[model samples]
Target chain A: MSKTVLSTRGLRKTYGKRDSKFDALRGIAIDIHQGESVAIIGKSGSGKSTLMHLLALLDKPSRGEITLHNHPTANLKARQLNTIRNKEFGFVFQSFFMNSNDTVLNNVILPLKIAGVGYRERRRRAISALKTVGLDDKRNNKANDLSGGQKQRVCIARAIVNDPKIIFADEPTGNLDSATGEKIIDLLFRLNQEKGITLIIVTHDHELAAKCSRQINIKDGRIVADSANETLEAENDDKEEFKDNDMDDMLDHQHPTHHINVDEEEE
Target chain B: MRMLDVIYDANANLLRNKLRSFLTILAIFIGSFSIISTSAIQAGVNDFIDSQVDSYGGEGYLAVVSNDSFDALDGLQNGMGNNKTPIEYNPDKIQTGMSPLTNEQIEKIKKIDGIDGDSLAKEQTLDITYVTSEETDKKYLIAAEALPPGNVKVSLVTGKQLNLQADEYQILLEEKYVNALGYDNDNIIDKKVQLAVKDDYTHKIKTFAAKVVGVIAPSVVSMGYQYTNNKLADDIYQENIKYYPEDMKNKTYAVAVNYDYENYSADEIKDKLEEIGLSAMTVEDIIGTIKSFFDIILTVFRIFGYIALLAAAIGIINTLFMAVQERTREIGLDKALGMSSKRVFLSFSLEAIMLGFWGSVFGIILSVIIGNIANAVFHAPGGFLESFPTFHLVVYTMSDIISVTILIIIIAFLAGTLPARRAARKNPIDALRYE
Candidate 1:
């Protein structure tokens, strides 16, 4: 009976036109309930990341409707959408995007600043958030000076500084070693369990997906598995789901050959 | 966020790239420095010119010169006013008319509109001699001005301005002439002096006793000439030309037209006279011409400053554009955190303004210091332009400094716009996707 905090109906996203048209997301219909932990499992070229981006209001959907908190977001102004993003949602990226020039505390205060929080109040809250991530001692350290594990922790601190109801993490531990990756995952799971915040992760690890309450497997812009009713052990034992989430299962890769380098967006 | 926070953030951004920001500011400093220095030079030069003009007796009085014909009389009139004019001296050229202004011509000028008084002008005569108070020994034989000395600017050293129109025979001795005539520093008021006149045109020799009213100070016009009213002059004129009725107006040399100044613009009067093939100009007009020439020089120097500013503006644009490129991910992160495009744009623009503000302030401050140093070195102190010497070689008025600062800031804004717009319009999703 829990209300859906965010949902998409027949969503589609395409790039380019004519002979070069490429579909990144195709007809995805899903509902995300409040306080739910969901993992979007996919191969490298699956549309899971694009779908996550659309759900987080960071990108416009090409078709169908995105309902956010019972409101249709199709006609929302960018400012209104930004307000929703600032107030209700947080994002954690695989690369740990942060202002390397800024101090650890200042990096964590970004969300509060965007929300127009006062200086002293935001600083206090940023300190508290850093403490939550066990990084209070490194508050004065420059972001670039921090270890990869610490940087991810700072990103986590920033993601939770505003006490957002939902945190959308795209491959949050993709760049980390297994031990540091497990720590980050444990921290995310703790935030979900203790704070009752919804967690939607775009990832390819079956073990990571098994930890979530629901697992949605995608391939080539279409859903191949929905594990809402499946048990955790059943998901772990499923050979087909394991193969579907494999990095090498992308023979009909929807992404371009050069798409592996996300850094090209700089030019 | 609060506006202060946004501004604070912009300041922090500048600090992050200290060397780049400093280099950008140097451009603005160069521009504003040139502006201040050029203005100071103009101020100093104009001050010197003003004082010289004052000493010339150029205030309110117009110069009438002969143009090119046989007008030796206007030429003579101009020759007398040479000491007062701000115009560069060219003794060979006469500007008005070459023909001697006859009595008829004088009468014709008096009829023109705005001629305000009965004593329009006085024609000077060279045929005169100043003797001692005894009226016996010829003391100083000088080109004496015989007529009511109307419209001539004078300052009294010890006494008041002499009443040139009084019926009594009164004279104001020139201060230099007082020493030459063997008088001490004692006040010359009420002292009786003798004038001997020998008019060649009228064929008469006369001597008259006149009361010396006051001693005149050195004037911009001249310190050599002695002054006397027409009371004694009229008596001498009547005695000499009583029987020579052959149109005795031939000796008329110059005419001074007095008009109520408020009734017509100075240009109107000058233009009106030019229509009749004559030239008329006030001391103010000559000063204006000189100031305008200085203004042209100042403007050229200012253009050099503008070039420096232009270079600075380009530097700002280039810096901000690079910042936009370098901070791509940061900008995306900011946008993702709910920064409105307008706020993003404002922050970038504010950053540019801060750069401009710092540069202009430093430039102005440096220029003022340099100007003061130059003033100390180059000021022809005490009496630069005697009438109105600009006190220093350079002047930094509050208004000038403020205006230049504002101008630099505006230019910085113009330079910042393109980069600001680019940052503001960036797509968060794509920007976040940037590595």
Candidate 2:
């Protein structure tokens, strides 16, 4: 019922040429509403990352169009796209990409600095962002000295420093243990619920996907199931191709117990 | 990104890899130091030359000689240095020393346009036997010549210039003669000195007492020659030529003539003289060879500086390329955060410029300090330049300093473009994915 914040139609992306030609995304049409926490679930190389990149405007689709607030983004210049990304979207990565030698406060100030915000004003906002993540006391500490979870929390602080309208998290908790991952997930969902900001997460963790208000399951390059619709049972007739065999194999290699639980719940 | 932020980041990045940046800057500094030092030395030489010219009564005056006499001097030089083959002797051409200018040629020179007829004075070869002062019995061999007519303000150690038209004999003593004649620069002024001339035939030495008008500072232009008033020079020359035959008595080797320098250039006047079987050398023509000699040596040094700068430019390129490689991930993060490609290029270019700026600034500062110390060392007592008090060993002009700095900065910027372009062209995705 909520107004759509971002929508895509017939979005496709291709890599390489001629002999090495490959398609990462094919015919993906989705509408993400304001304040909705949507999960894009798939295995590695399933075009889930490509879809998030296209939606985040970090990349352009090879074919089709993406609309942000009903305004088509295909015709926007590079400078305009950069501004939109700086002002309207935040990003959290699994690896915690940060200037490790820099102070935590400076790391958090990156986005605002790139936005050309005034020095004093940027410092104030960065400190506030750090406080929100409860790392203000460690603001002067070198980012490299922080533990993995603290480092990820600082990366989150950097992402939200500009107060973007949407947060695109790519495996945001992939590097953290379950307890720390839970804390990060709670923080992301709390921001989504309280600020009415859209949350678009790309992950294959079903437990994380189950918590989202909507889930779009992608296999290979096509959307196979949408939990928002009553297509689970109807789409199950295509179950010969939609079996959990591949997903369970990958999960089993990484998390043996999780693989057993996944099989038990599905059966 | 803002300009301030770009510059700030550039300087901070330079600090991140201190040793690499310092080594690159050191290379630039070597180039800058050599270039600026050479420039300073050239400036100092030129300054000293200008002072010498000013002291020589400045412009208008020319040392005029017969064409045959000029040719003879040239032949003597070439004969001593390069012309080894025996020559067929031609009686018409004067082949050694100088040929006397005929009276007919003198009359023609006076009639030439732009030649001030009244300023012509025969260059008399006064053969003085010796010189002595009333205060000391010791006689010193000396060379004294008639001071050229003009507003001649010689760089004097003490006292005033000689009165050209004074009936009483007056002599301006050289600095060496001042102390040798038992009188210092201060008390020697207005004191009497005696010049003795030996007759050509009888070999009789006649002493002429003259008052000391001033003590002249040693200078390259003067060449250690003393100057005397017209009266003293004429009396001395008359005594020396007393025994000569009629034909030889009137023969003149050269003449000092002043031309209307304001209305006509020196070359124009020289051309007029050349038409009348005469050759003339202006004060500039005499001093120009010295300047060209310095210019040649300094130009070689400047070229070496530029070659070093060329090497330093390569060093800058190497340094920045390494920096770009190391900062690939950081650059990706910045690009992803919305810093434009142009700004990224600008930051790297600014780092090169900053390196050049600091290198040149330090070069200038150190050069100035060392230059001053050298100047002091050269002018101290017993130093080579002690006799020439007005000369400085090095001089720094504002324009030279500014131009050198600008030149190095431009080189640094051009050097930077390669790496900056590389940094700019990096894709955020690929750069981020780089391990």
Candidate 3:
């Protein structure tokens, strides 16, 4: 049984006053388990991005509690939160938010450098991350010199360079063409499958949302729906059953060893 | 990752604005240069005066004259004064109202434990002649003094000094007179010269012949107002004479004494002379007059230097303020990266100090060149305030340079601090958004 990676309860955010107030997020409750790939789907101004920002520790909720990897976040100082963001979580944005002045390699290495990783090790990990995104050849190119798809790939490389446990991507491929967007989604899925990293993405693309194992919908600062994808529901259940069977087999093999240890101690 | 790294990064950011940094540094240099050059020149002058005074035999000598001598002689001629006798031209005439000290009186003074030897002399104006060549003769009687050989010290550069006990006719010439005579040592020494001394009572020119025994360099004592009163007369006389035993003893006028310890100070010597019934003046009085003149000139130079330095400081302040405004966003970025306000302030202040340090270096180099050129052109004797060619105005001692460097750096730090603090205390969000 994997632990829950993130949990938020009674989160509320309001802008302005009572009469002229706008509630960006209203009492949103959510839980995300480790290794889960989830998408948050909503229309423009649907509060999905605000929820993602709060979860990413980029913004503070007006009234709520948030816990990441079982660590309470409400009382953490700004520096401490920045440390957590550098160490435990990675972020990708719709605009690809790459530092225009830095080369692609430097951009990728920034998160690890911020985490105080030694230079050589940071470079190695950055190169590996760039290879994973299929942009290893573009390492020396400036981020601003890259096309929309290539820029998003560089952003992905930066996000995963520190090997964070979770990646929060907001409209990760929204600025790319449809084909390039699909390719980015496939690459993200591959990384999640192979590395067991949790992926929390917010997007308006229904096709991208349909591909995820779990989908959450938000509207008017409230969660409208949360359910497993109909197409992947049966396959997910089968994989869960197979994981349970493998655990049983391993436990059965260790039973005789446990009994032997007990007899030896008694003697 | 480290504090040094943070500073280095900030320095790189500052390097982007090279012109501003250069201008700031120039301002600091000018300020430091002004202070250092002024102090150096003052030190040089003081050193020169100290040397000159020491050579004139430690400050115990004093000049004494009658109290009425300070009054103009016109009052005595009007018959409206206390004593209605015509003022005699004899040196002894000024000796009235003054304590008369004989050889016995000086012996008593010498026995007073702290008292040293004293020299007494009398002076009179006379006409004299010297032959520069067999055919060319120059005549102009000069003011000449009769001094005791043992008591008076002469620095003779050429020829033999006069023998005190010998009944021979000999005269010593000042180096200036030697030059004026246009006769070198070979020609002047053993040369015969006649002096025409005017007898005050007889009102007749009494001619006496003497041999040039020694030529002395002009000492500060010998150049005092009492000795060479007339520049033209000095050239005409061309010498000082030693009277023989058969001649009448020269009437005494001024007495100069050198105290050993109890009253070796200039002021103490003057007081002692006054107590002994003679009004005395110290060498400091003459030096003081000279110093006041030097002070006026130095003050003018200092005023000009300060004006330039003030303009430079204003330039520094303006440049620093502009830097703060331009780097508002960068400062916010550093804060966002978790740098403390103090660290930010330190970076800017250090930059300002560097500016001052470099500016001072440049200004000092410039001042040295200029001071040297001035020294070469001006040929005045070095005193407590006057710098001459042989003496440098800007003495670049290790301690002096180090002190000036530290002072400039400190000043730069202060100048930069206001802008630095303002930048550091600014709201991070506002700074970040500042265009």
Candidate 4:
């Protein structure tokens, strides 16, 4: 019953021309609610990554439409999309793309820096994010010198530095050993439960999928199963579920009541 | 992203590959060094020539001679004319030396429409047998001539100009003469000097006392010749020609005059003189060849500098292209994190500009150091430029330095556009996938 944060209807993505044509995402439809930890589960080449890219607004869909907070993104300017990405959403990549030569603090400050935040404020926020990942002591360490697990932790710190409403983590722990991967998962779930931040994770590991509040299975670019289908159907019975007040609250940059509203919705 | 951040990152990125950036900047340094050095040399040469022009009877001043005299001199230069073999000697045309301007022709010249008649002064060749200052007993052999009329600006070391019409005899001593005459430039002013003219027939010498008005700086136009005012020149000329026959006494070889230069060009005045069977040569005509010679050499050197700059521009393009390729993944990550395509392009372009800035700054520093050293070396004792105290071998003007830096920066930006565009147009997904 939480407010929908991201929604798509019959989304599709294609690559190349007719002669060498290929469909990366044939069709995908889903509604992601605020504060809900959802996992997109699929094997290799199953288009789960493409679906995440579309939802993250990193790429344009070849067909259908996507809406953020009930507002279609088809007419959004590139500058607006960049602002939304920089201020409203965070990302954690599988390989941990970082400026390896830079300090850990600088790497974590990337999103806020992109948002043109002031030097002092961005630095303070970055330090706080590093503390969340328990790497505050290693802020000055070069990213390249960190261990794989530590690098992943630094990347998570970078992802949450901008205080995004949602964090889209693509295989957040794929490169880590089980022992370290377990710690990373626990940290992500802690952020979800404590901050009530919506989490959309793309992964193929069944164990990781099972930990999420709901799992959506994908095969050949199509959704094969969804654990929250019944809830979606029940919400479909009320067409006006996305109220104007909810849209206004979601659009506000300083929306501070999401956790309280999500807790009430959960109860 | 903020422009300041973009600029800072550009410099930081360049530091990531230090060797590559240094080598690229070195190439640009060569181009900028050569260009600025050539500009300095050109400026120095031009300054020297301008000073020389001012000394040689400045604008509107002309040296007038008879057409026959000019033709005779021209024939001598052209190997005594087209007649390969002597055929017949024509008595009417046979001339022993320069043909003197007739008294009738001189009167016509003074009456010319644009010519300033009051500025006309007969060129008196004063044959001073010897000159001796009151402080020195040694008499040095000397050649003195009357100062030409019309805007004659003689560059002086220390003293005043000659009073052309003053009844008392006055002379301007050359810099070399000041010390030889036992007097320095500052103390030589208004000092008495003795000029002796020998009468060839009787072997009798008459000494005339003249006051030194100024000491002349060493100049190409003057060439060690002492300048005397009209009174001193006429007295010496009359004393030397005291033994000459009556008919040859008044013969004038040349006369200097000033025309209306603001209203009429030199060529226009020359044409007017030509109609009256007279020939005139302006300051430009006398010193133009030397200027053209220097201009040709400097122009060739300037062309070489530009060619080097073109090669350096290519180096910038190549360096940026390689950087773009190497930072593909970084670019993708930045783009995925919502850095705009424009910001990415700006960052790379700023890198190229930074390279140019550093390269040109280094070039200017090194060139200025070397230029000053060369100037000092050339001016030291035993050097060829030792006599020219005022001439600098290389002159660096602020305008030239600024213009060169700006031009190089623009070129660097243009060269960077190729690689920056490629980086900006890259798809985040493909760039991230690129190994």
Assess the local accuracy of residue A156 in candidate 4 as a C-alpha lDDT between 0 and 100. 89
Model 1: per-residue Cα lDDT over B238-273, one tens digit each? 555556556654455455555556777767766666
* Model 4 chain B worst lDDT run, 10 consecutive residues: B71-80
lDDT of 4 by residue, A1-267 (tens): 889999876566778865696778755668899999999999989999999999999998766577898888877888888888887888898899999999999999998888889899999999999999999999999999999999999998998998889999999989999889989999899999988889999998788899999999887777778898844332222232244226434534532222212211121
Taking all chains together, each candidate's TM-score versus the true structure is 0.75, 0.88, 0.57, 0.87
Q: Is candidate 1 or candidate 3 better by lDDT?
A: 1
Native A-B interface contacts kept, per candidate: 0.81, 0.53, 0.02, 0.57
Tell me the TM-score of model 4: 0.87
Across B254-296, the per-residue lDDT of candidate 3 in tens digits comes to 5555555444555565565545444556555646665566667
Task: Give the local distance difference test score of model 4.
Answer: 0.85
Which regions of candidate 3 deviate over 4 angstroms? A1-267, B1-11, B29-33, B54-178, B183-285, B288-325, B376-388, B397-400, B425-435
lDDT of 2: 0.85
* Colliding pairs, model 4: none
Give one clash count per candidate, in the order shown. Answer: 16, 0, 4, 0
- Residue B96 alpha-carbon offset, candidate 1, angstroms: 10
What is the lDDT for A51 in model 3?
Answer: 89
Give the Cα lDDT of each candidate: 0.75, 0.85, 0.64, 0.85
Task: Determine which window of 10 residues in candidate 3 chain B has minimal summed lDDT.
Answer: B224-233
